[model samples]
Target: ENFFDFCIHSSGESEIKIKLFFISWHPLIVPIDEIYANETGTLTVCRFYTKGSLKDYIHQTKPTNSAYWKRYGRKSLSRVCDLNQIKNFGRQILEALNFIYDNGLVYGHLHSGNILFDLDQALPIKLLVGFVYNLYF
Candidate 1:
């Protein structure tokens, strides 16, 4: 079965000041694999996680579990998680947040949607993408 493999997440405010931060690698931060630009703004490319974002995981599985991706996608990629799994996820989120703060940066946007789960791993499974990444300040 086919899954949602790619998508372009758009933001209105184009901050050209962002630079330098994308070069380094961090376990909790989603690495900028490539960046595409246009007249309006620029968009960064990262892996399309099989399990998708944490927001999708929660919203899709709860209640009736009717979402197409949840229902028809490969069951192996997603699982019936346990309490300890949740606690582990929480710990990773904190680690990501700590990394941001330690670098003297503030992540203004923090939410479930900003966090992603990569059931198919190249790196750690959980990662943060949405951060106030204006590094050229």
Candidate 2:
């Protein structure tokens, strides 16, 4: 069975309540199932989406110092930088962070890699979505 499904099945009333509270207010943040490690352990498993992250896209488009000018010519890359896109990215990230902090949870592993980008064809531009946990941290 899925880890989240298993969590929902096994979680106590308090755990369910907290999960519901977080989900209700922050629809963008997907909560994974809370798994217990063994009969008594601090570790838990939380599975998240496999969507492509912002770092992936940024890396794809990153230009070498020389390629920077070669691709767009002598003109600075700033000329091609879309202000609206940058603003939207910042706004969404801030909103996500604010929501997490408001819940008294610290999002320690924040980075472009953690920010998933929605690349659905219907959307006008890329949209930064939720993040997955970094176990290394």
| TM-score for each of the candidates | 0.54, 0.48
Sliding window of 10 residues with minimal summed lDDT for model 2: 128-137
Stretches of candidate 2 above 4 Å error? 1-25, 31-51, 61-81, 121-137
Residues 1-137 of candidate 2 have per-residue lDDT tens digits of 64434443465434544533454345454444553333222232334434455654454433223353453344433223279878877776777766665554345557765566554533322222222221111
Q: Which number leads on lDDT?
A: 1
Q: So what's the TM-score on candidate 2? A: 0.48
Which segments of model 1 are wrong by more than 4 Å? 1-24, 35-43, 61-81, 120-124, 133-137
Pairs that collide in candidate 1 are none
Clashes of 1: 0
lDDT, model 2:
0.45
Question: Per-residue lDDT of 1-137 in model 1, one digit per residue for the tens?
Answer: 11111111232233222431442267778777666554433456676665667766755543234666665457624446689777878887788776766664456577766787664564434555443443223
Error of 1 at 114 (Å): 1.4
